[model samples]
Target: MSTSTSTSTVSEEYVSTASRPSDLRITDVRVANLHGVPFRSSIIRIDTNQGLVGYGEVRDQASASYALVLKSRIVGENPCNLDKVFRKIKQFGHHGRQGGGVSGIEMALMDLAGKAYGVPAYALVGGKFRDTVRCYADTPSLLDPHEMGERLLERKRRGFTMLKMDVGISLLWDVPGALIAPAGSRDDVSTMHPFTGIQVTPKGVEHLASYVDTVRSIVGYDVALAADHFGHIAIDSCIRIGRALEPFTLAWIEDLIPWQYTDQWRQLTEAVAVPTCTGEDIYLTENFKPLLDAGAIRVVHPDPATSGGIAETKRLGDYAQEKGIAMALHLAASPIATMACVHLAAATENFLALEHHAADVPFWSDLVTGLPRPLIQDGYITVPDTPGLGFGEINEELFRQQLDPRDPVFFAETTHWDGEFSHDRLWS
Candidate 1:
């Protein structure tokens, strides 16, 4: 497919030299590190021989090295042939933060593909299911339940119809008789849920339940509410906490245990009244199959940065729909990743709501240009009809202001990663 852009204003045009997708060849890969936009993040830029640059971001808290290391593999390929390039590099990815490289590249490729075909990213996958994507506010935890409720009410005042909050053992640390942890197990965060031997007492359950009750009383039943980050507690405690909070009618309880324990997830799902949701740390669509096949979860939450970017995330959502499960996305990165999720959620039929982690960051929307101000309004983001992931360009001034102090590089040259040292093929 051949495409052309007019020599218009910077916000209305993409600077490019080549007009045909067939002639596009990747020339270089670079990264910009940003910290304290809320979380540490790395944004990637892939330059092509055609002057068409595609943008993406690594998973929040993941190293930029994850993407920089793959520069050698994709330096000379066509960005529009996504699956062909994905297959060649996906072997380098695994679950959790390790998957960031492949997924980010996939997003960049999708962006280039859309621009090459003169369509939005959603069109390349299929057509969109909705014109605007609904977003849920992700709030941090506070020490006081009433204070947290008031804080959530503030989000509701801003027009969020859905919300998620942290309700974990972090709250019970001070209350005497609230927990039963053996010696050396009091502040354990590394032990697996099954081996932790940390149990929430009856008082602990009541204490946690009261927090949700306060929030529910303030927010009312007019909006959907979800809870997460319940600490590394065992399944029995997960079930207990899930049952106690059932009275408030939570939308779902997330990550009570790790996502890999499908059998344990099934047991918790069957035992609780609230819907069980997971898959944020999961890498690809195939790994989600065991959870869907066993009826272990009611909702699947995949961060595009960790779940394999726009196309793979769409595939995962489609497969979950076939199994009668709903899909919600977990996102906590820059505007590039947010727009990617917006396109993915727009195209997926069973999509629930996209998480907006930067709702409170004043400069978050300023990171990109050519989009509406207050990018989210009345709890929804209007999907862009523009080509690619649908933003004009990175707001260089604002981006520079948020650069990570440790490595304040803005799309610097990456010639060191240009030479491939070993063969990358999986089979002869």
Candidate 2:
């Protein structure tokens, strides 16, 4: 296969691979919503007549409208003109959460371009730093310590050496008199629009500590253990919970408070010995800079779907390297975003691990075909050696099984409010 390189006028240093000098055209763009899973995601499929198809996804729920609007901007552009296409779409997309649409489309284009050239997506980003990407399992939230231990053992049996659990829920039998607040007390949390309920109580916290202790005891000290979704509690409550679980030595405490609270994150990192990680909801590298520059946390986590797809996520990871920070991708969606992350992790040197949320979903791995190797073995995913993402085939059967009932799979018309706006600025 012949390859060509193009440099952006804005930054001569920014160069990317182009497919055959003239064969680069986006033939088709389609979106699919994979529902009923932990999170919803809109997957974008871009096809080219050159017999190459690329896949990318914009995070679900938060900004589906933005991603849909981006389809118009990308429909006729040359897939190989990555720099030009990204620049053009970005100008129309603005920044912050609204950027997801443009970013998702950009990811699909790159995936298509890579397949056209017969190189993994990472190679286009400047080549691979690692052949195998480390994976962390998101364990289920169980009510019993014994049951939680059983779940950990199951994950361990499947070869996962790193695991994360939802530690904020207290409704299980493990905690007694743990929930103190009335259902309406956390109305503020309710209004946030994404997550609701207050399950982690004082007794619940103690039970959770015991649960972590049990998990750590069974898994031993060699494995990595992490926690997240600590409920909508005050900073002091976070501190207390952090202190209680200190003995287990968690890998990091994730999203203990809202991600917007930079000062609170810094304080939490300072107060706890465990490493701190956040930024799944944050949009791009620019949004991540403040936390990295402030030394707010030892690790930076970004979900490619929400943070702007592969290229942007790679930029964020590269920047984090400059600050001596590690990058761990937070992903929970369809195979489109999961495979996109694999490419990014392969290219990034400072990358630590990537979350495989669908590890337990029987058909999740089947959603895409032609992966160069098994998605996971002994808790590690071998990067695809084939061109593009090496995604084999979309398992329509599996997709059907996972579709969200509330909103069936269909391409809705792009709402008018979706894309870049003159008044929009990323950070206020």
Best by lDDT: 1
Which residues of candidate 2, in runs, are more than 4 Å off? 1-19, 36-39, 49-51, 60-64, 91-99, 169-183, 186-188, 191-205, 372-374, 396-428
lDDT per residue, candidate 2, 1-428, as tens digits?
Answer: 12333334434455454445366676566666777455777767676666567777776554566666565566667887887888766754444456667778878877777776777789899999998999999976776667877788788788888888887743333345776554565445444312444445677677768778877787778788888877676666677788888888889988887777778888888888888888888876888898988898888988787787889889999999999999999887776777788889999999989998876676566677776334678888788887777677776777766666765665434434234345433458
Writing each residue's lDDT as its tens digit, candidate 1 over 71-146 gives 9988889999998998888888888999998899889988888888789999989989999999999999898989
Q: How much RMSD separates candidate 2 from the native structure?
A: 6.6
* Candidate 1 backbone collisions, by pair: none
Best by TM-score: 1
lDDT scores in order: 0.91, 0.75
Worst 10 residues of 2 by lDDT: 1-10
**Model 1 vs. true fold: TM:** 0.95
- Residue 372's lDDT within candidate 1 is 89
